[model samples]
Target: MGKGPMGGGGPHGMMGGGQKAKNFKGTMKKLLVYLKPYSISIFAVILFAIGSAAFSIVGPKILGEATTTIFEGLVGKVTGSGVGIDFTYVSKILIFLLGLYIVSAAFSFVQSFVMSGVSQKVSYRLRKQISEKINLMPLKYFDTKTHGEVLSRVTNDVDMMSQSLNQIMTQFITSVTTLIGVLIMMISISGVMTVATILMLPLSAVLISFVVKRSQKFFKTQQEFLGHVNGQVEEIYGGHNIVKAFNGEEDAIREFNKLNDQLYNSAWKSQFLSGMMMPIMTFIGNLGYVMVSILGGYLAIKGSITVGDIQSFIQYVRSFNQPIAQTAQIANLVQSTMAAAERVFEFLDEEEEDQFAENPVKINNPMAGVVGREFQEESNKKSHHHKEAEREVAVVNEDEIIEIEGSVQFENVHFGYSEDKIIINDFTANVKPGQKVAIVGPTGAGKTTMIKLLMRFYDVNSGAILIDGHNIQDFNRHDLRSIFGMVLQDTWLFNGSIKENIRYGRLNATDEEVIAAAKAANVHHFVKTLPDGYNMILNEEASNVSAGQKQLLTIARAILADPKILILDEATSSVDTRTEVLIQKAMDNLMKGRTSFVIAHRLSTIRDADLILVMKDGDIVEQGTHTDLLAAGGFYSNLYNSQFEDSHEEAV
Candidate 1:
């Protein structure tokens, strides 16, 4: 039942070779902290496992008693001695052995059950922590990491930790208990045979160590190639249409085949090397078993040990090497688990955004300058006149002492994605409440960078952006973002009904309000044409709807938000001419009463903008009304003129 020391599960143990984790000790120590909560359950598991393995360890000795009894009975009968067989003694030993195995099985079952729950609970908590960590991490962290890599840490790495931790904990306890109990029983029977068995341990260990050392490089390479192949598949599949359109199918296949072949080579080599450990360990174990058996028989013949003792010692010697092999396997599994845990721990340890202030800004409130209800009477009393008292009541209703005027200004703002390279340099702009300010620039210009700075996606290296005369940093990120809404060229709609997508901008918006917003965005008619109207479900990528329709939905979302400021990033760039006209009209309606920033490639769209900020290489080269800039015959005029010239050249 216990594999008698030489028996084992499989050679998959060696497949974990070459994965010696960096900072393994520290990672394991940190991982153990997560286990602290389940200490009681883990303790119970260990106890049950030890009991189970101990029962198995003692079974062979008891069975040996029965064997010796049978042998003696036969010998006595042949020699014509009195009272030849002790039937009652043999019967009792057989019954006790059966009971021992049953109890051992029960203990093992309980250990597995308890360990299952502990592992699952830890997995749940790890996932919860990762979810929270995602929100806490800054955008910059995501910008630097691949989405697949991040997801692997969350899903694959955590899963590995969960599975390996469960098995390792139970096996480690059982193996140690079995090894100890078996050794003690062997020594009690025949010390000489025990010493002979122990001598083979060093040889078995050295052999395992050699194979593991050779296989580690293969394992690491296999993992790397596996990742490369997976990435290639994901990229090629995700862009299948593009690849086909470009007639690059052969190239993609060739690259994939190359990576696949490399992965196969490493995988095969690693497995072969790891597989060698099992048979090698088995051979060494069998050698020890043979040595113990020979000495055991000699000792019994010389009357130094009984036949029963010889049988039990042989069983011990046979079982000894399996635990040693198991120990080596567990050690490798631990290294693998630690590597995964390190990734998870690193994610958990990422830098988080600043804590929200106790008294966060209230720009979302229409009357943001108001204090609170407690000061209402005092403010009313201070302002005696009726109009003044009314204003006082409004002022007292809001907590933060900030007004919501929606006037935004960039005051000598300078910023860069990286510290060493400055992308936006000492640029400044001002937009009055309800003004439409358009930013126009060449491909390398800092139009989007300016928008990102305004939204605090990336903080400026120097200077500041202000809303209603208060520095952007003065407002909590949540409160600050709540005051502005954005509709970008890339529309994002989750897997939900069209109505739900619109309601996402303002979660508490009613069905009627959603319809009104859709109507304002000119997508209401299109929705009505669908069988389910607003209830139509969008697919995961929102591909069920047309690109233009998706754009309209986003605009509808932005309109529903009713933010004090709006940012439109090429919002109508992807639509057909007719759809573009509808989108432009909807966007105009959305921006009517909000201070808006528009970044558009189309010069015609921004011709009527209140102020046009023309940029080149992070600098505001020209800033004025479109007519004024065109009349001045400067960079703005040339940029505006080049559009028609390019079209003419293309037509020719």
Candidate 2:
């Protein structure tokens, strides 16, 4: 089966929406820790925001003075008793009002610039932490989650938090400051009119609460369905070939339509409800304006307020309703920010792999003994064969390093992917240094699990794995893994040049060494035929090359690593018969002085193996040399005979 974008699982395998923060208050408190480092920047943002609001708030009142000056001058002109229209005084008020607005704009610009920087810095730090956390997290943590899910925490969630933070921080401060400042200014102008504006607030509040409450669920459902739609698209596209091969296009389209329909319904309802808020509030605000206008005209007639005061009160009324609307929107934004923060923090808080052992045993040049010397001689012979580029073998000081003969012992091992299902039971094996042991088994016989356990990818439940009489756990995980090189059925190559991909096995390997390793794996000839040769770039999926070539490249990588223990899991499965023969020869040369564990489905390839382990249902039923096992006429005989019988039937 072809793997989907999310490792073969469909949309239902992904995290569903409505995943709001369980403890929003607590998550916000934790998010404050990230903000703590930028407290000064945030404080500056708040101050600037307040300054912007304060300056802008005073503008209308100052403009009111200019209006009052013009009004008095016009009255004096009509009465013919005083100078008409004091142009000088009005000009001064107009200039002062312009200055106030300029200062307000300046404050707003500074705050926006500072807050943007702070938000990006926080995002950068969180992404960096999550990237580092991924390396420290246990493999088990990843096994349960899809790749898209983990990536969403890094990309989608972080972006959401950052964008929301950037907008909300300045918006919240400015809204509150404007609300309070405008209220005070309104009261100064006319308490009676201010009270009239204030009375409309209850109606505004009731309307806002109603819209927000009704729309919130639809918004959440929209978000959920949106995720589902995205997941379906990603999965379908990623495995489009398989879908077509099986004629599943109609089914795929049907599923997509189902999700898309839900998305449409939720999205429109949410948008319609949210869109109604402003218009509804505007109607109520207009009613308040009518009331305030009548009150202000009465006060003006009775000499209780100036025309300028009435103008200022009206401006304040518009300002007042805005903050109330923004406050409701900010509440929703805060919820989203907290939810994003919670996911990011949750990923950061995942259980990490125990990387370092207490008083860790350090193994140095484990192949520095007799096996190392023989391997060096063999490598020298292979280097001589590569006339274009000579191999550069690392020479280590034997005196400073302890020799690990690559002898492995699995003592009464028991393990499962989970605690409830024991797939490997009472497994025991002993492998001496430089032995070529082949494990042959039916599918689901725990062949791969044994290798994983040997490498400490997953520790055995009740027994210990030992290398040279030392428990594997005693060694640091990095140091322990360094002893082995693996080439599996599924070959992995990243998007890089062929040379870089091979050099990944040994980062410090020289160009000459890489070429030599490629030649040793029988990859140099085929690589030379390709465009750009070793410099050819692999695409993201590495699909530019054939499957067998990819497998060969991986083998070349392992050869370059020159590990003390070699693991070959259906390593030559992708290659043709002739290419397999060539690869098998190269593998024989590579395995000469290293302890090798070869898991093979084709039994013919391993007839010369020093030990053939026959496993069925998680238990090794037979283990001996091929000749010995065949002579026993037991489980190995039946398995060996059955394979040949199938081949003969196909041949006939």
For all predicted structures, in order, the TM-scores are 0.90, 0.90
What is the C-alpha lDDT profile of model 1 across 363-464, one tens digit per residue? 645322232222333433432111222331122234445557789888998888899999899998888898899999999899988988887878899998
- What TM-score does candidate 1 get on C-alpha atoms? 0.90
Q: After superposition, how far is residue 599 of candidate 1 from its true place, in Å?
A: 0.7
lDDT string, candidate 2, 277-323, tens digits = 77987998899889988999999999999999888888888899988
Model 1 alpha-carbon drift over 4 Å, by segment: 1-17, 82-87, 357-359, 366-398, 401-403
Candidate 2 residue runs with Cα over 4 Å from true position:
1-19, 366-401
Residue pairs with backbone atoms closer than 3 Å in model 2 (clashes): none
Q: Judged by lDDT against the true structure, how good is candidate 1?
A: 0.81
